[model samples]
Target chain A: MTKPVVLTGDRTTGPLHIGHYAGSLRNRLRFQDSHEQFLLLADMQALTDNAHDPDKVRHSLIEVTLDYLAVGIDPAKTTICLQSHLPALAELSMLYLNFVTVARLERNPTIKDEIRSRGFGRDIPAGFLCYPAAQAADITAFKATVVPVGEDQAPLIEQTNEIVRRINATAGRTLLPEAQAVIPPVGRLPGVDGKAKMSKSTGNAIALSASPDEIAAAVKAMFTDPQHLRVEDPGQVEGNVVFTYLDAFDEDRATLEHLKAQYRRGGLGDSKIKRRLEDILQALIAPIRERRAQLAKEPAYVLDVIRNGTAKARSRTEATKRDVVEGLGLFVL
Target chain B: MTKPVVLTGDRTTGPLHIGHYAGSLRNRLRFQDSHEQFLLLADMQALTDNAHDPDKVRHSLIEVTLDYLAVGIDPAKTTICLQSHLPALAELSMLYLNFVTVARLERNPTIKDEIRSRGFGRDIPAGFLCYPAAQAADITAFKATVVPVGEDQAPLIEQTNEIVRRINATAGRTLLPEAQAVIPPVGRLPGVDGKAKMSKSTGNAIALSASPDEIAAAVKAMFTDPQHLRVEDPGQVEGNVVFTYLDAFDEDRATLEHLKAQYRRGGLGDSKIKRRLEDILQALIAPIRERRAQLAKEPAYVLDVIRNGTAKARSRTEATKRDVVEGLGLFVL
Candidate 1:
């Protein structure tokens, strides 16, 4: 049986963080061997929000690639492409836009949440609002059968599927396949400050490329139990960020269980628990940081991988786009 | 002094009608020698509304080109290009979309009118809604200083200028020049059935390529003064489509004035007037029909014109896109 095609990507607005590693990148490392994966540096989508700061998007492309390389995402197994490099994506997005309604885009829950978070209430850019369609193009342009994403991104999958179904129904041909959203086991990692989500703009993210000093500083400033002022007082593990981090990263289940029980029963000091969590995080991130530092010195090798992968990606996207254009009776030339 | 660049085109939904000739194409012919002109066959724009009927758009490409050639639009002087052939337009449109807002797009009177006319209430396609941006890209991609358009399209030019200003201000660079709208001397021509506007879908338009028989048939069925049942009755010339056609097409102003005076005084018969108008129309349309027939025989020649012109267009659009990318500090490679 053929391996199902998987499509996934980063916005390239910043380097990959622990939240990304825990939520998606870790799963991608394993999937690289079993599935046909296409990882994209979504610079075009980044420009939708950062149109005035394209330099940030440009710099982050290499930074994100270094993080991916450090995390053991084998370039030989997965195609790593840049979004702006593929003209087919832009063409497909314009074609797909004809099927999506303005009202439907307005009702996208993910977009609504993003708008609320970004505080762009009334003056939301048209590109930002229509990015769901652009994403539909990105997902379907490869005819991707599966999309690995966080739970919060489920709406994006739905929008892509809707465009797929709409095009198939309208064209009376299955030109695009409906892609399934695969949520990783450790769905999302909370911010160091215990926010519900970890993001670059939140000032709570610890990048995979963070130095040992930076990681130590971030771990020390992590939010913890408020009422546990003394070592003898019982600390809540349910909302404790250190425990959450331990749950996501710590592989030694027996020790974690013992620590959790002691914390609930009392007498487990916040500093002690934090130290253990810090040790686990350091061991996890130290190798990645080292690999990133080494890879950062070889920019040509990194760009060469991206260029080769983007060309391969362009071939696949072009084939899918050609099928869609032919199915629609449009002159392909 | 350098010639100001002028951009204009037609949506390839159907062959050009007499209304197009009288309003825009006629003016384009005159400006072709003096101005740096770019004529686009807007097949992509046609698809926004006719997504399900791309075959219609596809076939009309040749038909529209024939009309341009038949109407004396010099392809060598006036670069005739296809919209979809150049990827720069799509890329620029995506960037410009970041400057336009959904709310602002909703407020566009032309889009509002189109939605109402197309009966796309609430379910309007996102592409149709965002076409103003695409149009802006078409105009500013060449940095065209002037755009010849109908009076109804004045708002589209305003929207384009707004985006131009917004991008320049945001990027802190004057990347695109604002385009001015130039309305032709003879505005919209009335339909054969006396409608306010001539349109292909209305089934009341006589195409520029219509044969003598078709023109004669259309002239016979034209909406005239309903109250003038007898030849002796004074006929109203204000709303008569025959007289309107005569007013637009007939260069013999002395004869037309004499006929108008005779008709007002209740001496000219409707059949005689129709005959005179038909004669004038046949005389004007015969040479155009011959030219179209000769051009239609050479599809290779027509397509070559489009291909060469598209290459020329691509060069200019690429240069402008490069500057915009550089201004934003985006990676050109």
Candidate 2:
């Protein structure tokens, strides 16, 4: 039996961090074994909001690729392709735009939230506003039945399905498949400061390639219960960054539960817990850092991986584009 | 010295009419000699508004191409290609969308007028709202310096120039040329009803391949001076559809002026002027109809013309896309 096709990717804005690992990459690693996976390096989508800083997107492509390699996303199992290199996606996007209304795009819950968060009022970039259609193109072009996204992003999957239904209805046949959003079991990983979600731009996250000392420093500075002034004082675990990291990274559930119980009761020091969390993190990231450093030296090999994967993706997508064009009775050359 | 490149096209929504001939095709015939011209069969643009009727757009491609050949537009001089086949245009359009804002696109007078006229309201197709960007892609992908547009469409050219400037500024060089709008000297041709502009959908248009009997019937049904009760009664020349067609088509200006004077002063009946108009139209349309009939027999040859021209266009536009991608520091595969 053929495995289900899965589409997932990162926006090439910066090197991904542990937040990406716990939230998505870890899930992607499992998908590679269980599914036919395509990992798109979404440089074009990155430009939707970062058009003025294309160099950042350009340079981050390698960094993000290295991060993927370091985290054990084997290229043999997962096809890693670049978004801008595939012309079919753009062509499909233009065609799909005619099927969706401007108001519908604006009313999309995902886009609306993003627009509000980014403070882009009426001056929103046209590409940013129309990205849902582009995303539909990407998902449908691959015929990927499964898409991994955050819970908040399920709306995007719905939008894609809406476009899928429209295209199929227009063609009088099922020309494309609707994608199901696979929400990861774990939620967002907070920054070391425990302020918000960890992101590369916020300067508070631990990259997968962080060195030994950097990992130690990030752990030392993690926020814990402020009212726990003394080692003997009872500490709250709900908002504590160190406890959160431990919850995400710790393999020994019984020992972590004991530690949490002790901390909640009394006499559990922040240093001791931070030391324990640091040990687990150091173990987690050390091999990844080494692997990333080794891969970083072979730039040509990494680019070749992208080039080969993109070529494969190009053929696959072009076939689908032709199918759609023919199904729509568009005059084909 | 290199000749300036001109970009021009007709929306493949219907066969070309006399309005299209008088308004643009005659000017295009002259442009083929003095400038390097690329004539786009704008099937993709037609989809923006006619997405519900892609079959019409598809069938009209041949009809419009036949019109071009029938009216003496030499494919050797003007590259005649299909818009949907050139992937570079779509890619460039997606790229340019990032350089402009949604509000800015909405504020474009050409788009605003079209939205109001179509009564699209907030339900405008995203593609229709963003066609100016697509048009920019069409013009700049060829690096065409001259774009033939109606006076009302000058704002679209302005929008294209804005995007050109933004792209050049982003690239830190002039990667794309700003296009100049070349408005045709003759204005819109009113319909035979003299109610509004001639249009195919309205069923008032005399197609370039109109039959002789059809031409005579259209001329006979044309609106004229309603108050001219007798041949001796004075007629109004200002709003007479026959006089308008005469001014547009009649080569003998002195004879036309004498006829107009006689009709206004008295003694020249509607039949006399109608007969003159019918004679001119039949002469003008007969050879075009015969050529159209001849060309329609060789569907393979017509398809080849589009195929060969589209292949040439694809290479040229791909080169430009590469330049823009490289100049913008986008990751190149």
Candidate 3:
């Protein structure tokens, strides 16, 4: 049986961090072995929110691509493409936009939350509000049967399916498919400040490509449970950043459990635990950092990979768009 | 001084009608002599409102092209192309969309009036709302300097220039030029049913390629002032469609004024005016219809003209898009 094709992407807003690894990128790495994958660097979608800062987004595109390569994501197994290079995606988005009511876009849970969080309110950019339909185009252009997302992003898939249904119904053509959702294991990575979600804008993130000294400094400054004032006093594990990092990245589950019990028993000091967690993190990230350095040296080679992948992606999309255009009689011939 | 370029287009919603002839197509004929012209068949813009009925839009693309040819929009002087054929337009639109806020789009007078008129209210499609910005992309993709429009559409130019200002302001680069509005002398033509607008869905349009019999039938069914019941009854000429058509199409302005005076003086019959208007229409339309028939034989040639024009247009747009991409530092090298 042909493994279902999966489509996923990220807006080129910033470099990947540990949160991305615990959240979705790790799953993307695993899926490459069994499923067809199309990963996009969504610079166009990024502009919807970052409109004033193209320079920011432009640089981040390379940063995100480097992060992806730094992880275990193989370009040979996965198609990594630039979103702006495909015109059909935007064309498809314009068509799908007609099928979605402004009221419906306003009602999108993810978008609404983003609007509130970004403080855009009614002052949102029109492009930002319409991005879900753009995502529909991205998924449909790839003929992707599956999309891996977090529970929060499942609504985006629902929105894409809504557009798919409406397009088929209105055009009376079944050129697009409804994509299935694959919910990644939502691992909550505490920020350096002990916030629930690690993010770049908040300056709470530990970047995937941070050097050992930077990582060491960040780990040293990380917040721990405030109630545990002294090492002799009993510590709480519920809000501990060191324990959370260990839970997220440690491969030795038994060892982590043993360390947690010792810490709660009021005998383990914070520095010893911090050192152990840092070792585990460096062990995992050292090889990725080495690979990233090697890849960065050959920027031309990395770019060629992205461009070739984009061409491959565009080839698949053109076939689907040809059928779509033919179905609508836009084909002049 | 160099001659400035002019960009104009029609959304492929239906066949071009006499209203289109008086409104914009006639101006395009005049433009071909002095300005470099780019006439786009906006399939992508049509999708904003006609998202569900793509087949309707698809079928209209050919019909609209035929009308352009029939109306003597010269192939040698104008470049006619499809909106979807150029990826650069979509890419440009995506970049521009970021600079426009939802409040700004909502504040557009034309969109506000259309929302009230179409009864879309809050249920308006997001695409429908962003149309002005998309139109800005069409104008700027070719760096068009003169945009011919009715007074009602003048605000679109205002919105486009606003984008140009904001982009230059933020990007710190004066790459795009602000377009000037060229309001056509003759505004909207009323339908046969006496509605202020001639529209296809309203079933009151006389197509540009309407046959002699069809025009006669449509003219006979036209609404005039109700008080003009008898041949000797003094009539109001203000709302008379017969007089309206004469005002728009007739080159003999002194002759038309005399006919209007006779009707207002209670001596001329409606039939006399109708017959005279029919004669005037036939004279203008007869050669146009003949040219249309001759062009229809080589449908392949018509499509080919657009194909070659599309290639030329692509080269022009690709050059601009490269500048934009490079300005944003998206260049891989």
Candidate 4:
């Protein structure tokens, strides 16, 4: 069977961080060779929450594109498009608003939880409330068969499929396809403070394009086993984030196994273990840093690629819009 | 000074009735000559309430256009357009949605009254709630300076101006113009049963394009003063619907006053007055009926006129969209 079309991206509120890389960006690069991929700089979606800060979104679009190129997300294999450039997505969203009830939107699990978490229970922006419908438009607009998202975002895909089913039924045309979710495997990387998740806003994330010094500083400060107070005390590896990073990125299996056994058997200090882990991290991240630095030299070319990619995305979307207009019976002439 | 622009429209929910004719179609015909007028067929607005049956709105677009032409709303002077043909309006509506709060939309006097009147209190279509914002887009899309509406529609204009002010202030550009309301002298022609309003849904409307037999039957059954139980008894003339129709359509002031006095002082039976009123209504509606019948024979040509008119309206709207996009700094390329 042909590889399924996959769509995923970040809202361009800021640069991609280590949390983003581990959660999605790295997976997107891997998916490119096997699936038809679309990496969107979702400026419009960013506006849902960042309405007062257009400058942030505007600047982030460039930063996000550069980060993607630096991280080996090939533009040739994965179309990187700007979300607002596709006007059809907004139009489709407006049409879908008719099929969806206001109550139904308020009941959307992910969006509702986000609102509650954001403490905007009574004062949610209507646009924020309606962004899920906008996401539905994005999925159906691309006609993607597979959507890669974390478990928390599975509800977004479910909402998109509901819209697809309703729109197809109403138009009496099967123009939009439902998308399947591809859940992330590693779940989430813990922050240096041993927090459950890493985030840019939480001051717990290292950026994808961070320099060697920044990464070293971040990793050096990471929390280890709390009870390993003495050099001779046995260390814990089960909940140790250093072991998690080693499990995810360390390539020297025999060396890492010896270090783990030495730590578990006692007598290994935290500094020695830190140095070993640091070497492993720097080796794994050196190439990503080099590639990103090279891409950053030509900001103009990166933007040009995004522009060209969006133009191609728009041409495909325009054809879909014609079908949508016909299906809605809004043919003017 | 160049002629100011006028924007007026009918919601394509049903056939045009005499209430529509006397209220708006009459003003549109006169205003077309004085201003650069755009008559919008607000099918999208109709869909807010009539969403379950979109075909009704789709089919009525042509009929509404025919009614405009039949009543002397000349396309040579006026541009008639379908609301959905211009996607820019929807885009404009989204931007305006941000400047407006949900509380403001809920507090809009016109929308609140309409919600209660339509029995859509809490179960309101969010689209229905936001359509005032949509109307703001429609009005400002053309940068229309004069909007002909009834007294009840005044708040919709206020809502539009609120957005216009916010847009201009936010963009630091005075691109959108404030539209003023143009209320007619007569609020409504009243139902034939002497009811306060003639609504299509109320089954009390006499269609402007009603056939000769339909018109004759409608006039014969029209409500007069109920106090005049006997033809010889004295009757009230002030609230009598026959006199109201005469006041609305009769150009001959002398004949109207004479008939009103004769019907008031007794001796003139209801049959005599009904007969005279029928002749007067026929005399008034004959040319419109003939035009409608003749246009009905060539539905294709009428459709072409609507197509051409919508194209012109769309072009005018696009010019405004370009200005707005530039004003908002949203023109990326």
Candidate 5:
């Protein structure tokens, strides 16, 4: 039996952090063994919001790829492709745009939430507004039946399915398959500052390639219970950044539970918890960082990986584009 | 010295009519000698509005191509290409969308007028709303300096120039040329019903391939001065459909002016003017109809023309896409 095809990727905007690892990367590692996976370097999607700074997106491509490699995403197991290199995706995007209405895109919960958070209002980039359709193109091009997305992003999967249904109805046959959103088991990891979700641009998250010193400094500054000023005072774990990190990264559950119990009962300090969390994080990131440094030296190998995967992806996507075009009775050369 | 490139085409939604001939095709014939002309079969653009009936766009590709060849558009002078077959246009459109804002696209007068006219309201197809960007892609892919458009469509040219400037600014050099809009001197031709513009779907258009009987029937049923019940009755020349056709078609300007004066002063009957109009139309359409019929018999030749031209266009457009991608510092594998 054929394994289910899974599509997942990150926008090439920045070096990914532990938040990405906890939320999706770790899950992707598992998917590589269980499914046929395609990891897209979404440079075009990054340009939707970062058009003025394409160099950033360009530089981030290698950074993100190194992150993927460092974290044990084997190139042989996962197809690592570049978005702009595949012309079929763009063609499919233009074709699928006709299947979706402007108001429908505007009304999308994911897009609406993003627009609000970005404060784009009426001045949103046309590319930004049409990204849902572009995403549909990416999903349908691969014929991926499983798409890993955050719960907040499930609406995009729905939008892709809508386009799928519309295309199928127009063709009087199922030319494309609808994708199911696969939400990862882990929720979002908060930033060290404990103020918002960990994001690359926010400068609050610990990058997967963070140096030892950077990790130590980040852990030292992590927000914990301010009310637990004395060693004798009882502490709260609900919003503590160190505890959150421990919950996400710590493998020894019994010790962590005992520590939490001790902290709630009294006589547990912020520095102790921070020290333990830092030790756990430093061990987690140090080998990955070292591997990343080693991989960064072989630029040609990285580029070849992208080139080969992109070439494979191109043929796959072009076949689907031809199928869609032929099914619609469009004039094909 | 290199000749300036001129880009123009019609939506492949139907066969070309007399309005297309008088308003653009005649000018295109002249441009063939002096300009590097590229005539596009805008099948992709037609899909923006006619997504539900792609077969119409598909079949009209040959119909419009036949119309071009029938009206004496020399293939050696003008490169006739299919829009959908050119992948770079779609790629460039995706790139340019980042340079324009949704509010800016919404504010474009051409798009606004089209939206209102189509009564699309909030339910506008995203592709229809984004067509200006796609058109900008078409213009710039060929580095076209001249784009023939109606007066109302001048705003689309302006929008394309805006994107060109933005792309150049982003590249820190002028990688793309701004296009100038060339409005045809002849105005829109009214339908046989005399109520609206001659359109294929409206059933009032006299197609370029119209038969002798069809031409005669259309001339007979055309709207004229309603009050002119008798040959001796003083008639209105301004609203007379026969006079309009004569003014548009009759080579002898002096004779047409004399006939209009006689009609206004109450001596000429509608049948006499209708007879004159029918003769001119038959003379105009008969050879074209015969040529169309002959060309239609050789589907392979027509398809070959499209194939060869589209192949040439694909290479040219791909080169531009590379330049833009490289200039923008995008990752080019």
Candidate 6:
């Protein structure tokens, strides 16, 4: 056979950062060579909470696209699509909605956690509640068999599987494939301020497309052990953000181990470690920043990439929809 | 300087009955000449509850269309389109979902009553809960100014207007027109069993496409005043089924008034009144039955009418969606 399809994407609510790179983007670079990859900029999903600020979502669509291109996600090998451009995804979502109950959606731990995190209380938007069904639409519309998602997003894939089984059972045919969630090896990247997660809203993220000066500043202010007060004092490596970045990005394993031992022995200074991290980050991000700057000057060409991918996406989704309509026994009229 | 648009439809769960004619179909025949009309065969909406039975919705699509044509709803003047064929309606619904909260949808009286009526309890489908948003999409997608509905369906119109205002305000432009509810003057045709409503599921309806023998059998079994036993004794015309049918269908005022007075004075028997009703119903439904039979012989021609109407509908909805995309400030990519 045929290669298994891998579907994944990020909501275009803000510019992607290194957190995204560590979590899923890095994994996609390898998966694209073996699988049929479809990367979506989920502008419609972003509107669930950011409905009042559509302009922000609109702008971030490009920002996130630039981040994807900067990270070496080849458009020729991977389809880079905008979620809202596929109207069939929305239609499939509506049909899938009939298969799930409000109670089932309410019981999803991922959505519940998100609601609590956002402090939406009892005023949760219906779109936010029903997003899993829409996500189901996105995955199954392409008949994706593998979905790359973070650990916290496991419930979303579970819900999609349920809808896939339900619709097929209702139609008495296997028209949709059940997708499996693939959690990335590096689950999360901590914020520069030592927070457990790096998020754009927290103002603690180093964006993938940051300039050299911006990267240097972010690395210099990176959080580390507060109690390692002096040049001679022992430093803790457990919760150190600088070491965490080093763990994720640094390729020299022997040098990193030697530095860790030196720091534990109470001779290495915080400034010395910060300077090392600064250099490594600049090396990683400099070329990416330059490529992004070059791509930024050609917005039309970037849009053409998305447009062409969307056309491919539409044809695939239309084929899926034809199966659904046939199973439903509805005449096209 | 142009005629306003009107949107109306039926959930294609069953064939259209005389109840439909009294409630909305009769009104549509008059409005189609003066306004642009779109009559939807809402197969998608039917699946909101009947997910397991796709065949019913699919079959009912044609049955409902035959009824519309039989009742003189001109396909030349009115667009008789299927809901599932218009993907834009679903897209609009997804966008509209962001503007309304889950709690707000839960509080909609129409949905609440439907849930209770269906005995769904806490197991209500998410699609069933979000149908008002879908209905809102259907109305605003065409920019319909008038919506013909029964008295019980008034709340559906209210919810549609709220979504329209919210979307237009959020977009910072009046891209959607607010729709007004138009309750038909002649409300309902009660069931032959004297029930308050004529429903297909209730097995008490006289279908618009019923044959002469079926019509005769249905009228012969109609419920009337049970206490009136003797031909010479006074009969009750107050809650009599025969008098109700005469009130709705019998156009000769003088003869109907005389028959009513004679029946109250005890000269007329139950059989006499039943025979009168049978004759009146046969005359009204004979041409409709004949037309439906002719149309049924040519299914391809009937399908063509729906296909052409759907194309016209698609173009109109695409124009509406363009305005929405522009207002959101999102690039096509």
lDDT for position B206 in model 3: 84
Any runs in candidate 2 off by more than 4 Å, and if so which? none
User: What ordering of candidates by DockQ runs from best to worst?
Assistant: 5, 2, 6, 1, 3, 4
Measured by lDDT, the strongest candidate is 2
Candidate 5, position B251, lDDT: 94
Q: Score the docking of each candidate (DockQ).
A: 0.74, 0.88, 0.65, 0.43, 0.90, 0.79
Best by DockQ: 5
lDDT by residue (A112-189, candidate 2, tens digit) is 999999999999999999999999999999999999998889999999999999999989999999999988887888
Question: On residues B1-333, what C-alpha lDDT tens digit does candidate 3 reach at each position?
Answer: 767999998999998888989889989998999999999999888877776677788788888888899889887999999888887887777777788888999999999998999899899988899888888888988989999987988898999999889877776788789999999999999998989889988989888777999889988998877899999999889989888888998888898899889899998888988888788777777877888788889889889888988898999998887876776666443
Question: Which candidate, 1 or 5, would have the higher TM-score against the true structure?
Answer: 5
Which residue pairs come into collision in candidate 6? none
For model 6, the stretches where C-alpha displacement exceeds 4 angstroms are B232-239, B257-267
What's the lDDT for all of these models? 0.90, 0.94, 0.85, 0.80, 0.93, 0.89
Q: Each candidate's iRMS in angstroms?
A: 1.2, 0.5, 1.9, 2.2, 0.5, 1.1
Worst 10 residues of 4 chain B by lDDT: B324-333
Point out the higher-scoring one by DockQ: 2 or 3: 2
Each prediction's TM-score versus the true structure: 0.96, 0.98, 0.96, 0.90, 0.98, 0.97
- Write one digit per residue (lDDT tens) for candidate 5, span A287-328: 999999999999999999899999999999999999999999
Off by over 4 Å in 4: A188-198, A224-228, A231-286, A328-332, B194-197, B234-240, B252-269
Candidate 1 has a TM-score of 0.96
DockQ of 1: 0.74
A233-299, model 4: which lDDT tens digit per residue?
9999878877776665666888878888988988888778777767766765677778878888987
